[model samples]
Target: MEQNRCEKSTLLLSVVIGVALHGSYSTLFNPLTGPWSIFPLISLVLAVYCLYQRYLNQPMTDGMPKLIFSFFLLGLFGYNAYLKTSNPEMGSNFFSSVCIVIIAYGFIVKLNSVNVYVNRKKTLRKHRKQSNINCYQLLVVNTARF
Candidate 1:
């Protein structure tokens, strides 16, 4: 159960990071725009919630962050691909940005998974030790009765 919770939290972290980065890029690339500003604001709220959950050592509630971010990325990619097809000059930038985002996303997921897995293993070891201690106590009591 704890392991499951940890995995969920880790997944949330990955989503938050991904969204936040995208939001940052949107704001940087297009300043003073109302729609682009919304992404960063939403990202900020989610980031705060993520930090609070981390501080409390609790799992984040499963939410729509991943779905929204995925859709945003897909839209961006489709738009870029369309642009590249129409104007070959932008093909290199489109591919490079896509490659960078993919690599970063992979790294974040892998790092979070390792951290969560390690914590889960440590908790499992602690639980096993506790069970072993109880068993030993039971054996001692039975031997004493005999």
Candidate 2:
């Protein structure tokens, strides 16, 4: 559990750094037609892949909302990229900012759910242990009566 938390935190940190760079460069650099474009594009692809993988790995009922949100953000990314491609003069800062916000929200939601799941597991384990002890106690009492 500790390892899982650490890994998650690391992933979250990477996402934050990627978003910060993307947002900062969107206004100053042309994200569509220069060397700077590569990093943002790569990050976008990576984000999409991660979202899709999460969607697939989780149950439909559990992941549906997140999947929908991921698609929405993906749509926005495509639209923004299109705009940038069509008109190099138009700034993509707004789009990048939007992406950053969506990613942050998604990560927060994911983290919350993970915590909830972990708690549930712990509770279930405790309940099972208690029930087992109760069953053993009842068995002993019945044997004594017999």
Top TM-score hit: 2
Local distance difference test, per candidate? 0.60, 0.60
Q: If scored against the real structure, what TM-score would every candidate get?
A: 0.37, 0.47
In each prediction, how many residue pairs overlap at the backbone (N, C-alpha, C within less than 3 A)? 0, 0
| Residue-wise C-alpha lDDT for candidate 1, range 8-32, written one tens digit per residue | 5555555565556545654667443
Alpha-carbon lDDT of model 2: 0.60
Please report the TM-score between candidate 2 and the true structure: 0.47
lDDT of 2 by residue, 38-83 (tens): 5555666666576566546643445545545454555456445555
lDDT accuracy of residue 94 in candidate 2: 69
